[model samples]
Target: MTINPSTLVDLSHKLDSNVQIYPGDPLFSCTPHTTVAKDGYSVHTLTLGSHTGTHIDAPSHFFPDGQTIDQIPLSSLITPLVVVDLTSRELQDRQTITWSDIEGASEHMSPDVALVLRTGWSAFWGTPRYFSHPFLSRDAAAKIFDRGVRVLGVDTLSPDETSYDGVGGEQGFGVHEVILGGGGIIAENLNLGGLMNQNMIALVPLNLEGCDGSPVRAFAWKD
Candidate 1:
């Protein structure tokens, strides 16, 4: 079972109307205007939030002075990644991921790594169950920022908890502010459960100028 470079694994979730979105976010929709039988061409009108499905959150997503998606460096999108499994803890107690969790996972992390938190929450993608789960704590976010992580990703809709009154409510904004303010990007709503081996990830986002964020086609390959 020697994996080679040609082996590609898609780490992104499929975008569709059924996919769950953050509360108050725009719903995904598509309408076909031309079909093979009608105009011998296929055309569709698609609509979705910029952060829909597997997408990158540029600095401007949170910080007004942050860089837009078009300004994201290509080197940051293509890099070595380390996947830390949080499924067991999420399923057992729905506990918030914290700095300690990142510290424990860092024993195997590299200097320039893309940290991915796998909470197995993607299983609830199309259901109401995905929105109410525990989220990453502000402490965890600060620790990640302190560690100089280039990119942060999670299986959940957001790293911050949904309850506006929760502990991370205001602090969570600080987290986004810290990371994006520091030129780091956040990748949300990812589907990385199927990827096993640690390898290189390719994150390609639409080149939309001045846009806060954009949808992305994220993938991984190993050797």
Candidate 2:
């Protein structure tokens, strides 16, 4: 007997206090204004960072001359995704994800496909341990850019490690510069582990004009 298509599993992580947010980034908060006991209505004022929770990074995030969230092409935001798991490394190892990693994980990466990296760091959400983890290296960023991939997603904070310091010299600006500079979009803080199938992933970002990035409601579906 086959199960109905509608009966398929739909796993989504709730955007709440339990969700781990990057340090120095805005936290999700809601201010209750009206309640049933007061004005017979319920309302709330929500506040959060543009990069809060699961979100998409516009080119402007890294390049001052790049396109903002509103200017991002819809074609690049939603498409087939290849899930690349890299959970073998320990936490905050500063290990860089190289181009070979991508090639080793998948056969071919199309120009329209979104690359989702699963670092298994999502488990450390809501704790100090979640702040730092293995990130993509500058070489990897160059490789993805060379391959013509416009969108990249990671299950961590930024593509750069937390220990990275942007001080003197060409410090702290490697992978992001290569990716965003190449006009690539980034989706950070995603929970891609819940999805079993790797068919297509839908990335929906809040349409905020002139904004570098915006919070997103990202999910994956398989038929």
Candidate 3:
């Protein structure tokens, strides 16, 4: 089958020094190692956390012996995508995305398919409001895993509530613990706004050995 590259929808945020990062994480920096004029070639030295920008969290993110970024199968990163767009719901800051809110998607949840929660939070990417994105409840995450969903994606910093200045301090990181502890993979900070009729997706991360996570060049296309 012939597939046009243009038809693929980009689902990753562009990485730069200005990309909003999770609090306490390493800041992204790109410095020129060699300039074309001086060295006859251009090379850049990139410095950033494994989970910087659009990235996938391997099971190792939470479990000490779980699969690492390089251990995950490439085929698992590329699969049919099932999107649950919640932008129309007018989600509030630090709101909990309960199971009932996504119960309708139970039918599509599976190990072979990638489930993406589109909270439309990508719009606040560079501001403090970006950290106030809606998060999935631990019960909801458990339910998703119960359905054999090993891969999950979200258009936010995390599926769990972003804790800031004591806000969301009680919620903890239950969602992350549940998913990652279950040996599942999570793709975070995705740019799902451009997604329309696309079905399949590829979230290819770097093969960083023993790394808990890695940035991915995520994209999607219709079958």
Candidate 3 per-residue lDDT over residues 53-107, each given as its tens digit: 9999999998999999999999898898999989899999988999999999999
Candidate with top lDDT is: 3
In candidate 3, which residue ranges exceed 4 Å CA deviation? none
- Count the clashes in each prediction: 0, 0, 0
For lDDT, candidate 2 versus 3, the one ahead is 3
Among the numbered candidates, top TM-score falls to: 3
> Which residue window of length 10 is worst by lDDT in model 1?
163-172
Ranking by TM-score: 3, 1, 2
Worst lDDT run of 10 residues, candidate 2, spans 162-171
User: Per-residue lDDT tens digits of candidate 1, residues 51-110?
Assistant: 888888999998888899999888888888788787666453245777776678766554
Ranking by lDDT: 3, 1, 2
The list of candidate 2 runs beyond 4 A from truth reads 1-13, 88-92, 164-171
Compared with the true structure, the alpha-carbon lDDT of candidate 2 equals 0.73
Q: Each prediction's TM-score against the native?
A: 0.88, 0.85, 0.97
